[model samples]
Target: MIQIKDLHKSYHMGANSLHVLKGINFDVKEGELVSIMGSSGSGKSTLLNILGMLDEADEGSYTLDNVPIKNLNEKIAANYRNKFLGFIFQSFNLINYKSALDNVALPLYYQGVNRKERVEKAMHYLDKVGLAPWSHHLPNELSGGQKQRVAIARALASDPKVLLADEPTGALDTKTSHEVMELIQGINDDGKTILIVTHEHDIAKMTKRIVNLKDGVIIDDNFVQQVRATQYV
Candidate 1:
């Protein structure tokens, strides 16, 4: 479902250039759950940004669902991003004033879904995430796990082909983190291609495959027996 080959990225600050990703190569199949694991400065974030089409690579190729992602105009890139990918961030990224239902509805709003269908789809996903009863609560009114659940619902509301999560369980307590991972695992079970960028070993273990990055390159990529998040939850 996703492919990258010889990917390279760099940032220039004054006379010096910081190389973020070097010769990265990987592929994610349609029903796989994978984690990109790395320490700070190991280029996981750069890789995620490139995969999400939030940033462009300085070199190499990326193809998402067989569509080549290179040199596209901003309009087309944004359109592909919206049509094929969904994102979950550690920060949740919800508007402070928007209620959980409205927050989940925001993506559909951008896609020009009408009010009735937007609310219907939003509520459906919120209920899927077990947050239907709290739909009227704002981000400030919910716990960290609840807020993340809302974010997950928002990410899924559009039914995108790929789900990209950055440090999805970073801010929560262990139990809550496990709970969130369980939810993610459930989503992957239903055949959603999911990629998680996280540094935590336990978190990476929750995924079916772990790709370890170091010094801007993939050092190891291995599929393991998936650990059940419910055991920890």
Candidate 2:
């Protein structure tokens, strides 16, 4: 569902340029659950940003669901982002004052979904994430796990082609992390393509495939026997 070849990115400060991604290449297939692992300065975040279309690569090519992603104007880029990608972040990017239901409906609102259908779709996803009862609660009123679930529901409300999660469980406790991972695993089982950028080993194990990045390049890519997150939860 996603493809990249010879991808490269660099940030310039004054006269020096720090290359973040140097000749990266990988593909993520439909329904595949994959994790990108790396330490600080490993460029996993940069890679994810490029894939998320929040940033662009300085070199190489990216194709998402058969559409080339390069040099598009902001208008078209935003359109593709809405139509083809969903995002979950380390920080649950919810508007604090908005209730969970409203938060989930925000994406649909941007997509021009009418209020009635947005609420219905939002409720459906909130229920899917086990947050239907908490739909009226604000982000601060919910626990970290619940907030993340709300975030996940919001991401899914738009029904994008791919889900990109950046350190999704970073702020949660171990048990809560497992709970979230279990939910994510179930989503993958239902054939939603997911890419998680995580430094946690056990978290990466929960995925069907792992791609290790070091110094802006993929050092290892392999499928593994998936570790069910339920057992840990």
Candidate 3:
């Protein structure tokens, strides 16, 4: 679960001041699948970054599960992110030479998880994403869908509470995108909060709730009574 109130982010471009988020307020409940949709320069990605603590806001407050992210020390925040948050990006962010398993295990390595236990957990997640057979393959060795699956595997390897996916299906074809969404749905079914940022209507429809942002502010918010996913099986 996460909550943001009066959140603001700004950047300086020479003499001009650019505001990315302007006092946005939103709350994501635990085990809910939500989407944030916006067009170019709408600050959806900036909001995601701020929510995930990768970027700081100039004003307002953020709380994850009950702890205030801005109130924590840098080291403590890093530890909390490692322990509770999973991030899926448009770029996949895989290491070029590392095998799928190795890349998925990278976060665990940073947390000092022992090799055997870390690798075992990584492989478990890889299999969950249907990439068990590709565990030894490198990023370049996999196709678009396969690469995304590996990325999802990496995100789940840590058993994170919430998954922040920014344009998660951006790099794949329609079929592959559905496949990835189904996998994410499965994750949500297992009780992980999922916040997806996308511009695609179909992608937004798959979620339980949708929030539209423009000019760094939420313009509309809708919650679907019935949850719809790309796949149930």
Highest TM-score scorer: 2
Q: Which stretches of candidate 1 lie over 4 Å from their true place?
A: none
Report the alpha-carbon TM-score of model 1 versus the true structure.
0.98
Quantify all predictions' global Cα lDDT against the true fold: 0.95, 0.96, 0.88
Ranking by lDDT: 2, 1, 3
Candidate 2: tens digits of C-alpha lDDT, residues 1-233:
99999999999999999999999999999999999999999999999999999999999999999999999889999999999999998899999999999999999999999999999999999999999999999999999999999999999999999999999999999999999999999999999999999999999999999999999999999999999988887
Q: Candidate 1: global Cα-lDDT?
A: 0.95
C-alpha RMSD of each candidate structure in angstroms:
0.8, 0.6, 1.8
User: C-alpha displacement of 23 in model 3, angstroms?
Assistant: 1.1
Q: Candidate 3, 124: how far from true, in Å? A: 0.7
Candidate 3, residue 232: CA error in Å? 11
The residue pairs that clash in candidate 3, if any, are: none
lDDT of 1 by residue, 1-233 (tens): 99999999999999999999989999999999999998999999999999999999999999999999999888988888889999999999999999999999998988999999999999999999999999999899999999999999999999999999999999999999999999999999999999999988999999999999999999999999999998887
Flag regions of model 2 displaced more than 4 Å: none
Error of 3 at 93 (Å): 0.7
Residue 185 of model 2 has an lDDT of 96
Clashes by residue pair, model 2: none
